[model samples]
Target: MNATTDLLPEWAQRPVSDEFLQALTARFGSQCSTALAVREQHGRDEGSIAAPPPAAVVFAQSTLDVQDAVKLCEQFNVPVIAYGAGSSLEGHLLAVEGGITIDVSRMNQILSVNTEDLTVTVQPGITRKALNDAIKDTGFFFPIDPGADASVGGMTATRASGTNAVRYGTMRENVLALEVVTASGEIIRTGNRAKKSAAGYDLTRLLIGSEGTLGIFTEITLRLYPLPEAVSAAICSFPSIEAAVHTVIQTIQMGIPIARVELVDVNSVRMVNAYSKLTLREEPMLLMEFHGSPTGVKEQAEMMQEIAGEFGGNAFEWAERPEDRTRLFTARHNAYFAAVASVPGCRCITTDACVPISRLADALLQCVTEADASGIPYFLVGHVGDGNFHFGYLIDPANDTQRQQAEALNQQLVQRAIALGGTCTGEHGIGIHKQGFLLEEAGDGAVQMMRAIKQALDPKNILNPGKIFQLQ
Candidate 1:
């Protein structure tokens, strides 16, 4: 078993010896599973990538359990993939080379809350919404939403951000420390609860967005923000997509302290209206939020309204009550699902690209024009305040031409993002579908450096093999 280089088979074709199986069974007992349902669930995520199920699933309940699973898989020279809430839009959960998936869902526990320091320690399995819920009693909250109630581990793994990111920043800024288990079964804790540090080597930042290729998170220590004293949300409609985007551009340029500013095209608004039973104006619109003192929130909203009106923002509505605020955000978060339902029996080949703030309108309009001209159905949404947007090209999965058309549009948008001095992906990481564009964006030299790091960390190539550039 120790002679992996000479004895291992080709990829997933490597046979799992009876002795290895017996060892796992004896050590973990009922925590180990070979159930078809569990394996299939861990094999894929919300993305459109097709992959084979993992050979087995282990429900990891603690950092030690994760260590045991990785140590055991290393003996058989098998891959170890981490699983969170299974809500990732990318194929981060897919076991492309068939290995053992460590389901961290059972490790959902909040370990500590340092209210004085505005930090909390939690297991990797806790979801964003759950974390906020758990800390609501303390008056401090975590701000990296990322739309879905994604696992904190998954969010940190992907370096996720959401609407609030326009003002509060992303996970990259909010995360302070992490506890990781390396491929060699060694635990590494990076950072502390302090607000600032002059530490050697920012390993926490390195592992945050590694996407489980470098190591898996066992516990996370995150920065927290106090709940705003006053909050306000508004919906504004524009005559055209360009007008709406221009408003966002102008608002950001003015340095408005908006907590969240989202853009929705007429098509997306129409779908949401039908699916959620809200008669929002069928025009390009912006959903905005502001947080501060009562007087400050009022001042911000008034300033935004004045700017919105300058750019043909009509039919503006405000949601100040808690119920109203919930309704507005719930509909916004459900937009992706509602869009898929709008086109019956269709799956989306989603596009996520971010351009320079000045080039936002150009990047968005070009893709919208092309998609409309191609006669394909799509729903457009964006965190426009940050120059990031998405287009869900809904197509029947069984239709060859539609799939090709969707992919073509996705490539065009990604290329546009890169050419405009921006990124190929703003939030959604480079999963299997976006791997082709990674090298195009990062270039050969940078990708090679990444590969070198991957090789140095996982020499066995047994940690989530075939992800983030297919190193070695």
Candidate 2:
């Protein structure tokens, strides 16, 4: 047996027998699968880097099933990787250590919607779109939209955020509580539905972005918001990239309550237009949204326009109708894939760096210049209003030279972000891809504290090992 496997308790090391497999089949007939191909498919996430398959796959349909599966894994000294929608960009779901994948999609269900308290409880496997659709008629909405229709459980696991994050806040702010299955098959509830409480430790916040390291989230209670009285979206073009970024900076500085403020470079604009079948001017653009009473939205729009004018921005192209706004934002949301589609058969390497507002322009300019000088085709898009931007590079991984160049550029970008007192990843958690960078960002002492917590919660190291940090 391998050193790691030898260390596992006897139960973990024993191979599944026909009887055991039959038992699993009897319990979860359609959900249990011992097929190598199926297990391999559920092992990795959406990242382009390393991928390791799990030993088995179990499609969990309820919290009880999750608890039982975890118990079985614990008895065998095997790892348990929690699987959601498998849309993670950072390889958070990759089964680095072979074991079992607890597929949570079957558990998808909206448990309850407490309209009176503006909170909803849901099974972890439920997708964000499903939840929104379920509550559409209630005049309430869950605003932590991450663009991909990712699962609520996965969003909570990664503390995900996207366009509306700048306004409605990320999962960290939306998740009020969680029902988690711990490493040892212990079920625990963290937090409550109350808006705020001074109660003990904030365990809910701790587990919000644990990425399945601390526990497997079985259910989540999230705060909700009433649908806005009015909503409007606009595309404002700028002659230069700097001008577009400056408009965002100034608008935010002026305290304009923008519902959404996103910056897309000219190159990305062309790609998006092509992918979405829209003929928009191929210029640097700021896609924005305003929400409030009709008059308030109009006033905000006017204020934004005035600020844009000072920066040489064009008149707003409004999308007032529901279908129009959906089409526009959907196109915007697909910018990453659109850029990837520009180069057929090429893989995408996306890197995110967040800097202080004062340094965002300089940082973005540095990235653009570096990418240009490296001769690597890339796309620049960002939540500029929040000083976080993503650089998507299309590379032929088969070409070693190109791969090295991309890595060099990524390292430089991350180092610069650290120098500027910013995080290596703004929203994406520190999965395996960013472990080294995370250590550098957190320093030895802080990293040590993180290790202490990990050990305290999972001494056996059977839950998503080889992630976040390398244990001593």
Candidate 3:
């Protein structure tokens, strides 16, 4: 009854054969599953996209397992979708072409740690938080925390960046290398342990944000940082969103190495206050963090407070103790969930846009004003210091008009960002939701090149079909 196969590439636009399916079950034994309950679980994730469940779910424990699954799917030309922690926001794991979902969650492992070199290799299923916890005793931490307990492979696939990105950069800069399995099930290493390389064709960067469309990442080598001796967090309230954004722009422009500078508008703050039980002013606020020696942190905090005072920002409230800092950021990290829970029976649609630091205020204000005018219950959260922000629009899925309106608003905002010389997606890669934006952002020629590469690597068009780009 499912006609999704009609959209797949001509090479793979056919239903999986019964013989190959039987062979697959016989080969993998307990690792392969076809129960309706498990298939439904692998059908969707944190995203709002609707996708039919895959034909089967393969719980792969190793690269060879992934290769075996891929090879089996290849024989029957069934598309393959890789699954990790299922924390993707852009529907990266959706099995649009009716294929097999390869669940890699059981492959969690921290392979090796090179403390002196400040790098660590981890299996794709290892979450960022788990990796950090594993290396906590090593006096170093993996700083790319994308809020969710997202697997390193999922994060790498999405090229995720988080609150720490303002100071530490995103996965794009942190990932040193990757071990990937091509569509044909051949395993290949993209980079080495060396910090820098003059290697031909930067393949690691290509696969970093491919969102499992190109190849599945088996292992990821990531850069790590020395844990700060003295870490401190501060919250500053502002008269308006503009003022708070201006302060972030000014702070970054002044070359201050603020570890994390997050902006939460009054709406989000109100929800967070109720959710986190924090008694703070219901005004636009910035949650900031600094990492350094004790004296350095003190100096940084003082300097930031001084700048905040210049832009109608209230006196900074500092959280110095480890316990206090944890509680503060935990609330900040829970903002998205807090927002969704604020209203009953409401699902959230998020929009991501990033502009030049100087243009952030304008872009953010435009989006805020439009969302405010739309009469939609929305909350604003951003990494303002880096000019990337997200609008969480709470909607009733039962109402089709609200969903349509939100989609239109997102399109307008993305166009505005492009007009202002910014990317359509700052962190969340272009899964099915942003494919149109990808065409507009990367232009025809670049998209063609991407298609060419996809065809060359996965000529059968079996790797996560209907993602990033729709092959003709």
Candidate 4:
């Protein structure tokens, strides 16, 4: 983990005084917990990064609850970390500076839905699936999946995207307004339900990817889309990863409106097969979906089939039944867990690098070659149509050497993506794990500008302290 150490913030944890704890417990009673188990749960996320548990945990049930917790922390000069569904992959939920975590999971609810306006306002803690389920009868659904049943607030904080991001945009584009609890415990609103607002600074965009550093989101208003009239999913296996990548690149370049297109490398395919009990072809595969009118879906499928065939892709399979499509996508989403399960007592250092479409082949191929040569076990998967992909390099938790090797591969991959005019992170925000990469990718001037905003908005630097960029 030495290689990863350089990516962490250079800050020491602040002590949580007895006075603060007593005050918090008095204010919230049972809702505030100092128990080790609850603190441990609030301290980490899905990623491999580790930290000491937060000093305390506050289970917030509503916007007022969050605001009160923030106020208490602010008064005590203690850092506050906002926690959602705990699905983040970049250590976003880690209490790196030893603060109290405000858990908003209990705040899950659909505040309002405007079907006629194609928008919905929700509590920060509602998961994407839950929101869809509550509004399924309304013939509208939110498209930002992020593979996890992550809280909508978490998605908004991290600007999350997933398989559907290719056609529909990421949270940065989909989120319309936010009700936020600021560092000083003041509640504020940014943006509104209107589609386009030439209004003041784009505070909504500013906070979308802030990773809980700018402000803690209590309520989020998001754009919604009507359920497609016709939906179709297909899978095609390629002779090699390059062939599959080329197929996707060509498909995107040709302006095909693919709803979702993902790549599963040979290694991931095998893992998925064993984990999901489905005998998919043992080759690099592209799982694709198209959404539109029946005729339009057919035309898109035909076009994809033709393009894939031109690249020597075969074993084309179509899944039109709802159950079949669900099964296939479930397998796809389970790829990460399957890989982890393959290696007992191991965690992975996942790299999220996205390059230009034309440079995707070069970036991916180089990373694959290096990962293969490094002798580190890894699984590759991607939302390739959008030139964004992930390589989860499995590393034994007890083996520091493997951790270093995985971090080296991640560093090389991020550098390659940056050199190719791409970003170090396409969807995952810069948590403690990617702080250095953010500096390298955004440079000092841009980062300083961001820091200035942070200083202005959170002068005390208590909002998810020790994340994104180092303060001093």
RMSD versus native structure for model 3: 2.9
The reply for model 3, stretches above 4 Å from the true place, is: 1-14
Q: How does each model score on lDDT?
A: 0.87, 0.84, 0.87, 0.91
The lDDT of model 4 is: 0.91
Q: For each candidate, what TM-score against the reference?
A: 0.96, 0.94, 0.96, 0.98
TM-score of 4: 0.98
How many clashes show up per model? 0, 3, 0, 0
- Residue ranges of candidate 2 with Cα displaced over 4 Å: 1-27
lDDT of 4 by residue, 409-471 (tens): 999999999999999999988888888888899999999999999999888889998888788
Per-model RMSD to reference? 4.3, 4.0, 2.9, 1.2
Model 2 agreement with the true structure over 130-229: per-residue lDDT tens digits:
8999899999999876678798888998888888877888899999999999989999999989999899999999998888989999989999899999
Clashing pairs in 3: none
Q: Can you give the lDDT of residue 260 in candidate 1?
A: 94
Query: What digit string (tens of lDDT, one per residue) describes model 3 on residues 229-264?
Result: 989999999999999998899889998889999999
**CA displacement after TM-score superposition, residue 237 of candidate 4 (Å):** 0.5
